[model samples]
Target: MLDIFLMGLLMAQYTYTGYDASAHVAEETKNASTAAPKGIVMSVVISIIGGWILLYSITAAIQDGSEAGLTTLNATATGLPPAQVFLDALNNPTMAKFLLFIVCGAQFFCGMASVTANSRMSYAFSRDDAIPGSKHWKKVNPRTGTPTNSIWLCIVLSSILTVPALFNETAYLAVTSVAVIGLYIAYVAPVLLRRLKGDKFKPGPWHLGRWSAVIGWIAVVWVIFICILFVLPPTLPITISTFNYSPIAVLAVLVLSIVLWYARGKKHFMQHLDKEQLATDEKKLLDEIDD
Candidate 1:
């Protein structure tokens, strides 16, 4: 039961990673405080409902009683992926290919959206000189009004980071672990910082009110627990093939970031929203007060 729950929790963490997509696009959104949160919630709810339906359909398809379906569903013997099960169950090459193509297209778009969100977030952070190569990454194309450099930066960095998958047998586990753990840590950091600020924390346009502290604490605790669980070896007798490298990868990046910040980043880095021009509401309030 414990093992089953652990794996289930791991999957949940992976699925929830990109729900912050709306937050990344806040700059371009109208009524951002309201809209972004709704976007996040809607995205998650839709994913859950859609995923359950798809899972049911796949499971049903596999029980078609055909010889090929039974063989492919025998995962231990066939060594087939879930998509192969679909192909075998249908027993029609053309239809199976079409269905697989649709799935692949959806996945491609999902990945593209995620990359878009990530690059935008990176661009925003760098605009405040928070990243190591701020000047380069923060550049917005005059014609396109997009952070073209930051987009490529994300693409290049992601490509480089994923190179280990080519050589490692359990690479998917390591990669997914790193993603789940790192994003949760990122999600938790500001919550902890807000907690530290206590009463001095300013209420946003969409503040949580009385439940803020409770929710924040719960998030912090859960994230910490997840991080610890993910870092530990998934199975005993860890070897080169079985070992999880996610914790090591995360720590390496963390250390490198710290070293870079101390060496050069601190001097150029500006506090987020400290630049008056970027504070739209504050600027409006100040103008009204002056008038």
Candidate 2:
């Protein structure tokens, strides 16, 4: 029961993911310091309200309280529980298909936003020479001011990552767990750093003021808790087929990152840009804008 509760909590967190896209696009936003934080907050707030309503609607639509209804939902012809609920509730195949179509459209937009955020992140890292082949990835399209190379890199890498799911269903779960765990870790790192820094940590325009420490600690702790839960097997008496591989995936990434950092990145990667270089880049961007 506890494991089921934890899994539900983890799924809720996954639904709340991707709000950080606001922060990733800050460089292109107006009054970014204020706007970006507000965007992130509002996005989460809206998602929470909207997601709750959607869930409530779905639950209310479950017309059957009998074991037969459960069996039908579980063995849905479309292989989707939600679609079965819609079909059973409405008794209309066309309506269920329409609802599923709407869901697919929403998922497409969500994926697009993720891709955009990932590409921007890669571009920023490449600009700092933090990644291999930085020279190629850091290039921006002159006409669109977009990171075409980084965008393509993100697309290709994401496509390759999904290939494992084609062969094994368990691999799909592991991939999702790894992705969520990785995202939450990235989200909480700065908050944890800020808490550790205490008085030395500079507060940004969107800071929580007197409540910053409390909220930051809560965020960090929650992330750590979920990360642990994510690596645990979802089912008991787990066999090879049901094993959770998120820990293995995460460890492999950590090892690879450490090796790369020690071998090359530590020497070449600039953690912070020089003030003169920043100014030069700003001026160059202004010149390009003017032209």
Candidate 3:
């Protein structure tokens, strides 16, 4: 059960995936410093409550393990299967179909929202010249105020990434595993860097205040732990079919990124704003005034 436990963790993360949606739309949001952070927290809180409730109901519906007997012909379930659980719980195919439709719709919306968020993030990063071919991806449509190129790029990349899922049954798990690991690293890196900066770090309007260091360290540590846990083989006696490709995918991306950084990014990539530079300039101005 390490595999089972890690899968549960993955489910928990997937349940809370859209917390950054507000951040993506912060430019259009009013009082973003206050609102954006609130959005993130509420999203997580709601997801936890809702996910727990759903899990409870599903467990409750599995009243008799004997009634949901295992099928020797099937490869998926050695014991009671989820499809049997749903059917037995609902006691009606019509109700099950309706529930399935609702779930499908929700998944569709979630996918759309993710695309929106990723595209916006790509556009913002590109605008700061952090991404390759930033000039093209950074362009915002004058009429729509949207990054069309970045949006299309996100779509294309998502499609390319999911292509393996069409051929391999376990490919979707690997894709999601890679996404979760990469995202957690992205989330933790800034937090760890902020922790290293210590008291000299400036706080935004919405910060942890006195708890910043504690919370930052906790966040960084937890993310690193989970990232390692998820990258391990999802099942024992790893075969080509059961093997997790997430670590490979992540390593490939890192290698490609390092190569690109040395070849072109080192010279071309630029950060639009440097808080350290701003602080230094302010100090210089004060010294000039005193002199």
Candidate 4:
């Protein structure tokens, strides 16, 4: 039982890693073209290995639990054969601290992966003149073939917000949960717009069509459910009191994301001015300033 819970926790962590690899390499590939093929293969390999690792860990945990003469699992591990085992190690201060570091580490990497992926998306969107800061983010470093500045910009911002994790376990989980939801919400746009709306926006040259929509909607719902569950006070509490204000934090993050989307993106929509118009606008601005 302990093993099963441990395994689940470990797998949750492995989930966060592979995505970042693809993002960090975004610029190196033939004008932003290479990561998809490499990313797909990379994901496949890691996912298969990651799954096997979790399976092995759970099997070992079961063996350990049986040796301890535990007919059933303890209260704290995650996967059951033990219903909810998030805190089996809490009784042991050292183990609790270790697990805290592990959870924080995995979630941190997961968030980092998100930062990578998002910067690529933001950079790509900007390249199309569809988002703010498009020119700078999409600019490749002359030598590295990386969106160097954008990568650092995102990493820095993500790290700062991640600071909240130092406060309490609940805060850590809540904010990450919110970030997770934001990821899927951004994904849903391409899905729902194509599938439900049929807005004549065909898939891009390198696009996933009908199937993507199905997967996207399913994933969105799945993630939403998990995000909600994550913030909910655990049905079983490991400590003296359950946590609070998790949903509130989630709301704040959501609001911030929305504000950012509009503050940065609103002007770009349907407002693509040709070079001449832009030059004229710039000249006018300069004249007004001089006046």
Candidate 5:
């Protein structure tokens, strides 16, 4: 029962993965400090409400209650249980296909949004010279005012990463796990840092106030718990093919990040700008405005 609950929780976390898109695009947004946080909160709230309705409707649509029905849905021709449910519940293949098309369209837009967020983040990192080949990736297109180079880099890398799914079926699950775990860790790192800062941490334009510590700690714990769940084997008697590779992938990334940080980032990465640097930046902005 606990295992089932954990698996459901893991899937929920996966579904909730991309809510931080608001933060990624903050640089280009007006009144970003306030709007970005509101965007994040609203995105999660909307997802929860919409997801609950969708899940309830799908659950209600499942006509079969037996183990055989489960087997049928699992082995459906569409390879999607929801599509099978729609077909079975509606008794109309055309309607099911149309519904599936709508779902696919939504997913296409979701992928585009993910790419946009990733490119912006990559551009930001490159702008600080934190990534290799920063000079190229940091380039913004004059006409579009977008990071064209970083966008293509993200697209190419995403395509390359998906190639493994063609040969290895389990690769898709492992990749999704890596994405969820990687994203959540990135999301929580700053919260963890702020918690470490304790009373020294100043409140932002929007904050949790007195409930901040409690809510922040709960979030930290939940992220850690889900991250652990994502890396665990999904089935019994795990063999090479059945093994969860997410942990290995995540460890490799951590090792690579540590190596890179020590090699170059430690010296070059500025965690905070000094007063002189801030003044220079302010002056630069003022000069640009004047021009």
Candidate 6:
């Protein structure tokens, strides 16, 4: 039973890793890939330390000679559901409060870090006019030299997300997992686009050169694999609605909208795709600012 639960936890961690990698890249770190890499490394280090500490504490507790072997659940004593075992703490009030405070601090810090990345992604998508509500999401306040509209949009979206979670925790995880798959698929696009380079493949500072073709092909396949893994049903037997596929469904709608934007209606929507020049200009402006 422990082995099975642990396996599920590891798989869930993979989905979480998938979700975080995007923010680590083009969004949060901007041009500083190394910073994102370092942040990820540090996060892993801290998490492992925390896990080790928890393991040692549990080991000590088990040795204390409790009938259930110091198991927080104490299945025999509590007679409550296994889930509530962890909540049944043995700590003193003062120490328990301190632990709660530390937990809150960690969560708040995570929120701050996540928001920084989310806002940047919103800005980037808006700048390219790809988001549905581009004007607000991509908007930049000249006075502040920042994307104020983008920041507000993020707040609205985050608030909206909390509504669903009020109903169920599994709902939230399933939904978020699905959304992440679509984002991953979008991320793989540029990597695969370099295959023929056709005519408009402008080489950026991060060029992979002769290996660029191979990289794109490899990345596209990897993305597909990740998407499949993420979209799988949470239960042993895979079924369509059993787990979250929201991201793929969302991406499907976006793709349809994009098609109409280009061919059927909303011609202005296609303009964003024609803005390779924006990336070029943005890069130049950044170089000048650095100079």
Query: What's the TM for model 3?
Result: 0.85
Query: Over the stretch 224-290, how does candidate 2's per-residue lDDT look in tens digits?
Result: 9999999999897999999999999999999999999999899889756788988998777555444
lDDT of 4 by residue, 83-159 (tens): 22323523465664566578679768766666667677666676656655676776878898667777876777777
User: What are the models' TM-scores?
Assistant: 0.83, 0.91, 0.85, 0.57, 0.92, 0.59
Summed backbone clashes in each candidate are 0, 0, 0, 5, 0, 2
Model 4, which residues run further than 4 Å from truth? 1-27, 31-38, 41-45, 58-63, 66-115, 122-140, 143-145, 198-201, 204-217, 235-241, 244-246, 261-264, 268-291
Please say which candidate is ahead in TM-score: 1 or 6: 1
The candidate scoring highest on lDDT is 2
Query: Which is the better candidate, 3 or 6, if ranked by lDDT?
Result: 3
Q: In model 2, how large is the Cα lDDT of residue 37?
A: 88
What TM-score does model 5 achieve against the real structure? 0.92
Looking at candidate 4, the ten consecutive residues that score lowest on lDDT are: 78-87
For 9-96, candidate 1 gives per-residue lDDT tens digits of 8877787778888989988898776788788778988989988898778767765456675555665343545666666678887887
Q: Cα RMSD for candidate 2?
A: 4.1
- lDDT of the structure predicted as candidate 3: 0.79
Q: Where is model 3 more than 4 Å wrong at Cα?
A: 1-3, 66-83, 271-291
- Stretches off by above 4 angstroms in model 5 are 270-275, 278-291
How much is 240 displaced in model 3, in angstroms? Answer: 1.5
Q: Better model by lDDT, 1 or 2?
A: 2
RMSD of 1: 4.1
Candidate 6 achieves a global lDDT of 0.59
Q: Put down candidate 3 lDDT per residue, 90-166, tens digits, no spaces.
A: 88878867777787898899889999999999998787787788999999889898899999999999999999988
Superior by lDDT: candidate 1 or candidate 4? 1
Judging by TM-score, tell me the better candidate of 1 and 2.
Answer: 2
